[model samples]
Target: MTQQEPAPWDPALAPADADRRLHAPAAARNRDAILSVLRSVLPPAGTVLEIASGSGEHAIHFASALPDLTFRPSDPAPEALASIAGWTTQAGATNVLPPLRLDATDSAWPGTLPPGETPAAILCINMIHIAPWAATEGLLRGAGALLPTGAPLILYGPFRRPGRPLEPGNAAFDASLRERDPAFGLRDLGEVTALAAAAGFGTPEVIEMPANNLTVVFGKQAGR
Candidate 1:
């Protein structure tokens, strides 16, 4: 018999409340820092599509902070979708829509968006290194097809940068990730940028984020 794939990370901590809300420790620690960068980059008003929205904590927090923008959070996991719905109901955030069950590797991603809602920007946090490389390729391909010119595709995670040594913490994290799944590990920033460029994105702006992570933003070019 084939061995079952290990669940991603540890089980999330849940509260005593009857709601399906689940908490990811990292989400609480990094939400504010990520929000600070988002405030400057996201458009003033419109929908934002978030891929692999694990635990749904970020979606509620960001929606609460940026009331003008509508947030559509999606994940492939059923538990994550339940958690997102639970958080949305608990927070009473009108700007956040019901979470979609989306898979990054799907070629028909545009069809998954809610009717009459074209995202002004796409945000993916802490996804790349934890999944297979095909997921990243599919994400770029889908974002390229869905976003209009000058729209942004923002990615947040730990990356291996050229000519710079990995911090001790990130190094250990990378090792742990690889140990979890051979396909999982830190991706090189240069390769990621190149992949985005090929998908019709312009040169990315890399920002230094707390906890040795980085936020990379790529703008869709005028012409494909």
Candidate 2:
């Protein structure tokens, strides 16, 4: 997927109490493509907790499409949470829960789960490369702790692979991200896979996506 400049939500950007809907220009373009991969990997009837859910547009669209699955979208920013709620409300998405404040780097993930609700899948899109390396580690560790065997932890992003030439767009995107924050940039796929294996996830099924993005599907290992 194409990278958007990372900015943690600012409540001042919009009014929380208003019936306004925050829009991400890219969400509409990518949601359908991402949903196709999700449809193949996600469980039929269980909660899907999406990390760093920007704009909440994807959450609403996915929830509407997969009525059998409950969608819980979370972000670290207050404005993002409000936007998520607004979108859910506007869409009348019964399958979506109120957005939770979640920081991917924090060990205490999910902080407040819906009562008696455990995630059947964890969906993270366009987050890792925009955040610190610690966040990716935290995501894997948290998924190891929270997911049961056979449950998938799905990640979508652009990554660098060995012996493969980086796309010009992605190369520039990586440089721009690093210029924004030294800690954030495109990560090596090998390192990510090794980390996931160490975190008790089996080998990932890498699917090519539009815009040089990849949908990496990894399942929780039993009794790790």
Candidate 3:
């Protein structure tokens, strides 16, 4: 599960003639480890919204692993959406819905109430550092609106730990990300915690994962 196979559902026709930024390989390598952590943090079964589902790799893997849970994969980019559809076509996965056009910074990110209720979970992975600060704030604000009193908002990514010497690996990774785009770099974990707290989420449960990244679980408190 650590290594992702060639995506099973890439179509011959380019997904709307767009440049493809392949991210599934890395996502494949990390999906299982992430799922292991998710099992402990999430409700036994529910709908999950995965923001920024690049290359559609994680959506495929997670949908296969958690059949009881329906996964909603979303991305702002059209090419990514195509790749997700291609993957879905190949896997014939009933648990994963068609890719949703979603952007974290947008005030109206699309999501629907279930047959009679809101989403059971909101899952975002590797999004904050790649986008601007506004996206991060919007993600928190949107999470507060979508989840119930005791649901969870799960985020996974590499982050800087305040007051600690930077791990060489993380520092180098940060440098590489910034090189790609100055606005993209490692974010501070403490700041994320503060943002979550302000948005009515409880203290985050942080778990160390592969690649020096982490899984931070923020649950909506019971009475806020």
Candidate 4:
């Protein structure tokens, strides 16, 4: 008999180790909300690679909930890798793969893409808005190479537009990001769409998510 799965957001689990670092506490808070969309969008069974999986909070959370699927979480930072290992150990999650050393800026992905298989899905949440445009270009292009036709490149984050009224919080956030580095700020949706097309992803389906964010799903083009 198949074992029943644990709830995605549970209050009754044993405590996490204090030494584990979770840089984005907000990830845990928003995890359940994200998973609701993921459950609907993600394939029933296949490998899912999460890019820039800071602290591995989403890796463990989603893996636990979607036990039928395997989750591979990757980040370039060593500190993030350590946190991911810690979270995997703490959660006792079997479906989650070891944290991979992947930088979205790299042309070649680090981990072995499964034999005779592309990753069923490529996910990146809360990354492009914070990183430089080159990173965004790399992400879309690299993901294009790693996914099959119809596969999804799921991006979740805030975006900007020239004519649209900016949300007060997002405007302030964008200002802060620009202050830190003028090159970084919320990206425009139309600009991102063009990048996706150049990278071989088809038209994107934009979904409004909670907390002023959007989920954009772009499909890979037919036949490479």
Global lDDT scores for all candidate models: 0.87, 0.85, 0.78, 0.79
* Model 2 lDDT per residue over 1-224, tens place: 44543332334553454665677755777789999999999999999999989779899999999999999999887778878988998888999988888897998775566567789999998889988999999988888878889999999888898789788878887888899799999989899999999989999999988787789999999998
Better of 2 and 4 by lDDT: 2
After superposing all C-alphas onto the true structure, candidate 3 shows an RMSD in angstroms of: 4.7
Q: What does the lDDT come to for candidate 2?
A: 0.85
lDDT of 4: 0.79
Q: Candidate order by lDDT, highest to lowest?
A: 1, 2, 4, 3
Candidate 3 lDDT tens digits, 65-84 = 88898888888877788778
Model 2 ranges with Cα > 4 A deviation: 1-20
lDDT for 136 in candidate 4 is: 91
Error of 3 at 89 (Å): 1.3
For residue 49, give model 4's deviation from the true position in Å.
0.5
* Number of clashing pairs per prediction, in order: 0, 0, 1, 0
Clashing pairs in 2: none
Q: Model 3 TM-score?
A: 0.86
